[model samples]
Target: METTTATGGVDEPGWDVDPDDEIASVVEALGHQQKRWREAAGLGVAEFATAMGYGEDQVRKVERGARIPRPEYLDRADEVLGANGFISAMKEQMAKARYPKKVRELAKLEERAVELSLYSNHNIHGLLQTEEFAWALLSTWRPALSKSELERAVAARVARQSVFERSPAPELSFVQEEVTLRRPIGDTMVLRRQLERLLEVGQLSNVELQVMPTLRGNHPGTAGLIEVLKFGDGTAIGRSEGAFASRPVSSPRQLRVLELRYGIIRAQALPPGESLAFIEQVLGET
Candidate 1:
């Protein structure tokens, strides 16, 4: 009912939200539709949940994209709202969709990069994800994925670590925002395994990991997450703020801008050895 006001854009209703934006477009559409109906009916989440035979918390989570809807629930809701198979089509999109475009490019880059550097602000980088951790994160989304998509995601994610396996090995480094270490992804066991994996990988000759100190009073990377990828023969690409559109950094000025910022961030971060110790301290091993 209030969908127009919710979006507030006279020309745009909402986002197409890319069919495979990795979070599952089906689920994303479900969320949009639910919000559309709720506002149309002039009801709050709790009231709507009661009407739909579910808990208010569940409804709220769906609305906020913290959970996915079951197919049967969607069918029932669709019939009630006279949406006429809109949600059903979205379910198909969820099952058939491949990985999102951004992630797909990242997968390619992982395989191609001669050296990779990542800076994480709010969460662990995907390339470093463990199987359980990746699945746990993916399964919690609103449009649930099929088993195949899940497996593809897992394989692709694990494969990214193979950059460490190259004979020469790509030069790797990560400057993690202090908050990432504090965010407990997956369960304690999953997190512990991930940390242990980090230690193992950090020991590799080509890899370096640094933690930007939460207590450092001031830091250069406080600006945002940055990933500057260097390829063979001095070619490179860059992604930032979060993908303002992954652009080429071929020009000397662009490359210098990234290199300078990255250098400053790395300098401000703890040294690799100290960073490992800092991680251990956060893990309560120290």
Candidate 2:
């Protein structure tokens, strides 16, 4: 039999709640409520843990707001403490709290974008990556992340895919370096699936996917990645690795520079139809 952690799932650990997170107060309040309900029922920590089928330490962490309780844990606690549906109702908020801060911020920006222009030289853009591909790529980070951290990061990346499902979808344009397609981040099958995903996304009416061949020779994108997001309010934000210290810029002058670079990069890349064919060929080779 496999040993399970206090989080209840096999080999899965509870997420450590970040005290500085924006949702920290909400989680703390929920934890306090859980504790109050248990005490009102005249249950001690050990007794409560036994009732909920979790370890005492884990239960203590949840009550102290140091660990984020999983949905099942919340449901069990609600049933055991007779809180009715109150404890379980916090699951949706807790789910959002589990994602990293940066992911949440970026997702909000993507949600507001009416048009997105992007150029990625090192790897496939996050929006175009498959779940397995994202996992394999993130796993290569130095000073390796813990299992809980890795799973959370992958979840955050995959969650951004919701942008593709939005009604009146945003116009998405992407230019990827030739090498990104050839590099197998996970395994043969992983790369194949990722390539297939690119083909499918490329076919979307609102999306245009292009590839910059390795021999394309000294382009504006050679310096690094570029991104520009335009909104309906006649405002835009942009950033380029080679300019503005790579920080986001919103002034028209700065935005214009990034747009120009991105425009040239797109023009130099393979056309959408040819790019899809190229990706399909790469998939076959895989």
Candidate 3:
């Protein structure tokens, strides 16, 4: 196997996967190791299944990387194969792989951003969402997530907030529709906590938060969400949910149009100070 490349880069299976690529290599490694260890123990698939008290098909599927084994499964395999904690420790690495691929890509982009602007119509922006708020929103979405999936998503969303703590803090701005504040996603307490979080984040010198009143009739942002991220290297990416699926665009012409639309939306929305007051009033009513 190719272990290392000429560029001093790792050539291993797990070292070179793109963010959008399938992350099966690590699981595959675990499976291959399990099979070798089982053979060393002189146990056939059927004998291992009997010892582990699981079906032979289940054991075979796990060994072939066709299924993600549960923690208990790994624990039992470790004990039966006499591999100490090696097999069980793979569980921790697998947890990092549980997050959806798209989310992982988005998180990486957000991490490197020096400036970010967001406009949300249907819900609060993800960066500002509290843990409970994110849990309620994601857990209740259509085609509900499995328990592990929901946990992974909530953790990933909350982890994005680490951007706020970056050295030489990034410039961040958010424009949320007034209706989003009115609709309670996770009951009144959750709504209140979310509003409080907005207040806290809005107080940061590098952050700005505004609200577009519902009574404004219609506007450029009415169609959907918009996001723009700028990097220190003089490159930027913009995406819009209204016109198309959220795909990054770097063309200057396209970016100019998006910037113009976003600027107008910000102008029409309530000023940052007034937006905070409005949020406070809504919180009081709740």
Candidate 4:
């Protein structure tokens, strides 16, 4: 609910799409329609904002399409501007734009995955992150987030765990760096809770959790985080992201290479039973 503006005049916690993109165009069109309706109702930004119970700056930003308006914002704008259902009807489109584009794309990929292999060299995988742990991890992100943005991301990341509860759940495997488990990103309590969550998840029939010991010298996963998602139709795609940007690897040759490296990393990691024991030991020390 809290918001801030930077010196450049953009909302600190808002989303942005390329100006010429289709989504941007739709948002702009909606904004223009709202402005026209407000003008027809003989209301300035201040009056419209006061009627809508939002800040005047927010009113201006929404009308300029510089901010992605939530459903409630659109509904209030509709009532205050006398646009009836017209303004609020854009809710569906805005909803699709709610999450960052990259997140949406990744989420769609996850939806079709029948099995997933994940190797984390740093933080816990998003699908396995506890709410408090995710909040702690995201809060320290370099660019920083507005309170609202942070909450949105944390919710999205945690929601991904629903995959674990799916009927005929997808097979899932995770190999996390030992250091990631040891680092108390949040205080001791948060880290302990997260480790406990991992222990619970590791017990699932379709899930396997492994840990790569810090004592182990250089390994295949030292390159960064690697993820390969396998679909029911025998197709698989992968990517490794760390110092370099991520790109999908669907070509059979590339997938084979990634699979080979991932196989080696898995071999190097502690087995699931040993990994659970290690986690329990860490939890006790905590």
Candidate 5:
């Protein structure tokens, strides 16, 4: 059989599966199933690697559940082992396993939200961030991340932007501090693109983007960021850096407090129209 070129070239790095992750068991089961299929087909690791155009080490890692297989890896394996579509069908689960656990949890909440109230005091909110800006901001994490970890983080953050494309789009309200816009997270070009992105998303009918000037001192948001997400079923979840130890709270009373703070923050900021104009001015100055 001719080797398929679907594995992104030979021996491409695979995603390390975190053993402590909730999805770890699922990945391990999939890997075990793949191994069983390979054995049933009378293929050794080396033979399977050659058939799939992957390195022997990569094949071993995938079969051992030490790595998260890419979609193409599963596809190539299915084709090689003649499992019909059985092996390939696990791609969907593997896709979710590829992201960090925290990101996955937050994404699930965002997916359920019908309305999101967000205030960012230091940096642009993740949903409204450009890929470049996200990368630059994440790169500054104090402990630093490995290359693979950083790439996964950036992808996860960008994936959250899909909320904007949902049918019957969610209502998204964002309040960004003035310094967030003026601060160059990456380079001038990166910040410029990020500002331009804000303008684009701000114009969406379901989105309200406002900027809180730095001059507004001692405001409710001065303590920190606040986020409240309301779902269609009347249930809500919220968190504030300055409240309840910054833990996510689902109780009505706690949510009300967060909502109140967010409301005031939005009211204290420039109106949406003026915010867009301010962003444009910043873009021009950039």
Candidate 6:
């Protein structure tokens, strides 16, 4: 049996939350494995879906693990597709899947990013979030966690900010919808401290803050938020839970679409010089 030795009574890393989390990751692992098996077998999703007595849509969902494959479904799929043990092996990996895969990808990207650009709709972007904000946000998730879990989550999020202080720090730019400033996430004090932090943050030459106003008539990004990242290699990617539907889009076609919208939004937004004043204005309003 594998052993986990404690150091000063601290739990070791790699422990998972629950069966659900493990199952979630396995769902993804299964999906990827199934896709590989299908390719090796020279089959298409539609063809495989038909063979397995499932619709194309359901097949896609199964592969993505957005929908669990019922035991009967899995048995039939395994029999028809010849993926003998893939689904069963996911029991451990699924525990890691409770969180969204896109979220985990974003975390990894943030850690390695040399620059990050943010645009938000309903809430403050994660990189700018404070402990109180993060705790409140995570606590509101369904299948609620205990206080210790929430703290761990909050700490994990806050610790991610250290990338900002690394040698030759990454550039950070934020574009927030004007409504966020008025939302009042925490109480007055928390909100005030947050806004003050924003001011201090905005003062950094490597950081910029911009606000998109309601007055800027409806446009592309009017639908949701986006984040564009430029990495150390100087390759850039654009992401929005929007157009390519939240998938990581490094393709020129997708990036151009997002790039065009981001450009217009920036133009309609208060420029950096005015943005400082705008942040101060909201701070005064609080």
**TM-score winner among the candidates?**
5
Using lDDT as the yardstick, the better of models 3 and 5 is 5
**TM-score for predicted model 1 compared with the true structure:** 0.60
Candidate 4 per-residue lDDT, tens place, 1-286, comes to 4454442222322344456555677777777998999999999887776677677787777778877787777887788777879988988677656556568677767878999999998898898889999999999998999777786677567656768877778999999999989888899999999999999999999999999999887788888899999998999989987422678878888888788888999999999999999999989988
**Relative to the unseen true structure, what is the Cα RMSD of model 2?**
3.1
Best of the two (2, 6) by TM-score: 2
Clashes of each: 3, 0, 0, 0, 0, 14
Best-to-worst TM-score order:
5, 2, 4, 3, 6, 1
State how far residue 244 of model 1 sits from its true place (Å): 5.3
All-Cα superposition RMSD per candidate: 12.9, 3.1, 9.8, 5.0, 3.8, 14.5
User: Which of 1 and 2 is the better model by lDDT?
Assistant: 2
* lDDT tens digits by residue: candidate 3, 77-157: 899999999998987555545446778678778878999999999989999999999999997887998665676678668
Q: Please give the lDDT score for candidate 6.
A: 0.69
Residue-wise lDDT of candidate 5 within 168-245, one digit each (tens)? Answer: 899999999999999978999999999999999999999999999899886899989999999999999999999999
Q: Candidate 2 lDDT, tens digit per residue, 142-257?
A: 99987778878887788778789988899999999999999979999999999989999999999999999999987899889998999989898888889999999999999989
Q: What Cα-based lDDT does every candidate model obtain?
A: 0.66, 0.86, 0.80, 0.82, 0.88, 0.69
Alpha carbon lDDT at 266, candidate 5: 87
Q: lDDT of model 5 at residue 229?
A: 92
Identify the runs in model 1 with alpha carbons over 4 angstroms from their true place.
Answer: 1-102, 142-147, 242-249
What global local distance difference test value does model 2 have?
A: 0.86
The C-alpha stretches of model 3 lying farther than 4 A from their native spots are 1-21, 26-98, 244-246
Candidate 6 worst ten-residue window by lDDT: 7-16
Query: Regarding TM-score, does 4 or 5 come out ahead?
Result: 5
55-142 per-residue lDDT for model 6 (tens digits): 6666676676555444455566667767777655554333324334335566668867887878898787777787776676676788
